[model samples]
Target: MPDAHPHPEPSPAHPRPEPFLARTAPEALHDLRARLRATRWPDAPEDAGWSLGTDLAYLRELVTYWAEEFDWPAQEAALARLPRFRVPVGGLGIHYVHARAVAPTGPVLPLVLSHGWPDSFWRYSKVVPLLTDPGAHGADPADAFDVVVPDMPGYGYSDRPTGAPLDSIAVAGLWAELMDVLGYERFGAAGGDVGSHVSRYLALDHPDRVVAVHRTDAGVPRFFGDPAELAPEEHAWLEGGAAWGAAEGAYAAMHRTKPQTAAFGLTDSPAGLAAWIVEKLRSWSDCGGDIERSYTKDEILTNVTLYWLTETIGSSMRMYHANAAIAPAQLSRRVEVPSGFSIFPGDLVRPPRAWLHRVANAVRVTEPERGGHFAPFEEPELYARELRAFFRPYRAAAAS
Candidate 1:
């Protein structure tokens, strides 16, 4: 692979990226294992089976495996193998993976992949390599990308904001600066979950710098405009989103309203962390009630373990509170940049074409049969293909 590190700093005042490798100390692992083993597990009624929340029996089994069999060292070693770096962006040390396209047959576009809550850059780990080296993956080398996956503030290895949690727009500003530091004047952006909102802001705020934008979910539907003006399909989509929220939005509401309170329990108890995250992994995936069908025990544990080791569950959730403050006009702003959407069938809610057009310059939209909310992680191959095809026409924008 070609070196993807940024060019020499333009000035001493400008901070340069330092190579980063995530090495958890021995004591941290020891404490994590002990915490998993010492959990004061609660009981669930027989046949409760995910009707209420995380199944106690399944959690116990998962926690037992986490305590005894899961290997953090191996997982950490795998993570370390990626081309990782941390740079000072706006006083915070932001961590990201910068992988240059291998053997490009055409202009290599720079792409930034942002992640959401519960998971960090881990969301794009599998798809990064595929995007960076499409030829090796049985695709046209012209479709290759110089991929950058960053851990948004308060997630993964990035330092948490001290005063105010960064909303999607704030993070997007940081990304524009980060990409500038990495010598990319214009780049494509894509993400899901909270990442989708951040990517939206990137295009909305930096239309001159972002070549194009892509997203998985269109974000939770809300009316910044009059309801009577909306199409019938839009009304149906909004109604579905409301129904889904009543049943499944407790986690997000908690994140927005009381993340700090929930954080303490999740941060202190490994079992609690797993239960909180694993439930979403099951509920929001194409796993059909069997999470392991979508992700192995190792894959699931790696993400959860990163959260535990960093103790970032609280900080990550704080983004919800920050995002809740975005003005209604900003939330309703339609992205003019050429945009694409791949709405997976198993995701939280699928926005109709009219709704997408109402929100974005929807040049392309496809509803693939597989994957869900975590499409990058759930269906990386499909996700990679979605990106390559969507951004192919926009490569000229990045190059110019």
Candidate 2:
């Protein structure tokens, strides 16, 4: 990996970005370990595994490993090697990774990748290099992208919102301004989770600027149009969504309603934070019930440690509340921009062809055999290929 340094110095055309290095003060890390070690034990039934909630036995083992063996410094060093920068966007210093395409054989289209909650820019880190330099990774160089992944406000290294938390629409406006500052006249947008909503808004609000949009899953179904118009697959999807919500939507409900109450313990206890995030990682991925099957201990800790060190968990969850307040009309607006969907097998809810077409100018859709909600991190190569193929047709338009 290249040594970390500021790229593209300040010039008349483009504002310079302050190079950002991931470094946690020694005292902060020490305090985290102390908290992990001092956690008060919680009792669970011997047979309760993940049936009730986060498994107590697994959490205990993970916490012990975190306190005694997890190396934050090494992980921090590895993260710092990525080309990270913070630039002023809408009066906030936004942290993002800007990696120019390597040895492009054709037009290098600028692409901004948005990440959702629970994980920040870290969600797309593994796939950055793959998209930026496809030839080196055994793919066509013409498919390379000038990749940009921004940490949404109140997530990762970005500044937390001070007043009202930003919903997806507000975040999309911020991203448009960000791309403007980066000198990209037009670009492609893609994301999953909350990010998928942001990208949808990006295409809706800036149709002229975004050549195309791609997403992993459609946002939680809204059921705006008449029920009689729905196809069988769409109806089945709605039923599946309701079933998933009944079984697994409690966390989202808490985030939408009482985030602050949960934030207290999550912020104070590293073990609590890990349990909160790890359970979702296990349940939401194509891991076959084992989280390590998708992400190793170090990979999982890197994401959790970011939340722990940044103290952004509360602000991150508050986004749900902000999004909840979106007007029904805005939520119902259909996107006209060219769009694509690559629904991973383990993702939360898959919107069928009928639902996808009802929402956007659906052009391409695929169902990869493996991966899940966190596909970029869980299956980087496959994720990269999806973007490469979906966006290939739009590259000429982007270049023009």
Candidate 3:
């Protein structure tokens, strides 16, 4: 038989590498608190619920706590523990934490983990230790992996490029290059939300390199078909979700159409930042009536502060605009790679097994007892267990 495989080359224009620096220290938290305490809050009609969108009174209260009680230094110290590095890929400086397992053995499978909007590399901090050092979590040391978590372009420590389109597909190509640079000839990929879309593209476009792919949210069915041709259940799922999203996705629409205009308030006022992000945590998470139970006040503030300090509010939102221009048909190209899907209860759309089976080689489908959009942070144990089981077969196959 003829050789059916060939390695790919890196893109000519590489992303510029930028130094990773901590913008806020423990002392800065004090200054932020002072600003929050002095905030002149906005007025709202009495009895306004979330329908009015982040009641000013409620936000003021959160910000007051954030300013007075949240510890930035503690969060920074935790992040500093990770071994982070910056690399240039596709004209954007990418920051990633590359944690290798301590096991004395041959190369382990390289896994590139990606994060979505309203999140940062911090989302995976909890999962990284588990994946890279499974023994520490009371799992087999052989289950250890070389974990790579990158802050998507225009997010976190990565440099946001101007006049360049950085959609999910393009970002996938960048991941391929980053993997190549790190000397990983083959690896697995996993992500949720926007990360899911990018991971799909990586597996599809570079099937030879991506041994397996995992995603928390599947792509919208419309990306895979004409509504008229979709199965009745699929149509209902998409339409119902679209209607709800349209009604509730004011943030998405605003971000897609005019991110810069919206960035002003979020970047300037810490209160505005909390109101915008806190609502999503509350509404989208499976926290059993209290978001703080799933996520600490410090956790939420750390993510927000990453955006505010880096001034990435506008750039991160630009992803929505970039993706909007890509046709659904284009986004739906079949990903011919082994895939895994975890359908958490609170996901925007819980795809039926039949629907996902049509898209990729879905080997594992998990119905978590709890958790939502932020799987890694919200339910680390469940997320870690599902990942281990999903990749166990693949890891065994590779060994054989």
Candidate 4:
């Protein structure tokens, strides 16, 4: 007789049969628009400028557009053009996109791409196509590989963890498990902002599995024992950066202390959500004082809509509080994996080679002449080239 249990039907040979569609129910958008129209404005001091906070007039205009002209269905259709998948890992339902190369002999080294705060997996949409289909982007066919982009737990379609200690370390573990489940024993990783921090933790904790790691703005803050130990330039950078943080990072502070309270405003009104998020994209990017030049208004709204539609703004921000409670000695145990850094000009603190070497392999560091915190989105070609170069050595070794 044939084996009692024949091999289970092989999973669809193609990992992702269809790209992710927004799938936001029509009622949800109607309710969101209703909430936006019903928002109650708060009074501010006379002569209060953006220095005091987000401009009320600008926010109102944006809200007006969101209600009247913004097209979520159109954006939804655009997203559906790319392949997406969901895999169960660590008892959580993780949503990700897996795009494969066209060439039959293309390398199959898996790559897990992570996104950071004030952004979602959507941030990687532009670069994902380039990485998976290099030939289509005018790059060598040999450069192509399989790409995986996951919406972190409590973000997008992924199931939210209630009162879960879902910090960077925990998330990194989940990524490793996801790779293993997908049959990738070893893989490369890349991220920016909070994504960068998680990528570092992933490489550090699972050095053997992570063949190589790359980050755009790896959020490694300056460490000074005392004021006297700081170099002049380091001190100047710290002071200026601190001043900017104090003036602008109220959201971080709130997220640290009372994320639940802040979530009320974000969840209650779409206009409030727009102000909270759009400001960061404007201030943090290399926009040269023009937000439109860096990102389209539709791009900004799409990011915000992902958060609003999923109702994950609160759980996502809770990560800051969870991490803040951990000590530095515990945070910087030194990752022993090959690492690459792309220091964009607009990062909060641009670390010198010496500083990054202390924590990671620091094999590749590029001070790109252009781009900012959102490097992948603002300069996709530069980002793709740097990533390919950093991982080339490892890719060659794996192939051999």
Q: Candidate 1 — which residues are off by over 4 angstroms? A: 1-13
Candidate 3: residue pairs that collide: 14-91, 15-90, 15-91, 15-92
The lDDT for every candidate, in the order shown, is 0.91, 0.91, 0.79, 0.78
Specify the poorest-scoring 10-residue window by lDDT in model 3: 3-12
Quick one: how many clashes does candidate 4 have?
Answer: 1
Give me the candidate number with maximum TM-score. 1
Write candidate 3's Cα lDDT for 282-376 as tens digits.
77788765777888778888888887777787888889889888776667677778899999997666787766776778878889998898989
lDDT for 32 in candidate 2 is: 90
Candidate 4 has which clashing residue pairs, if any? Answer: 19-82
Candidate 2 lDDT over 141-224, as tens digits, reads 999898889999999999998998999999999999888877787899999999999999999999999999999999898887
- Quote model 1's TM-score: 0.97
lDDT of 1 by residue, 187-207 (tens): 899999999999999999999
In model 2, the worst 10-residue window by lDDT is 3-12
Backbone clashes in model 2, listed as residue pairs: none
Candidate 1 clashing pairs?
none
Error of 4 at 139 (Å): 1.5
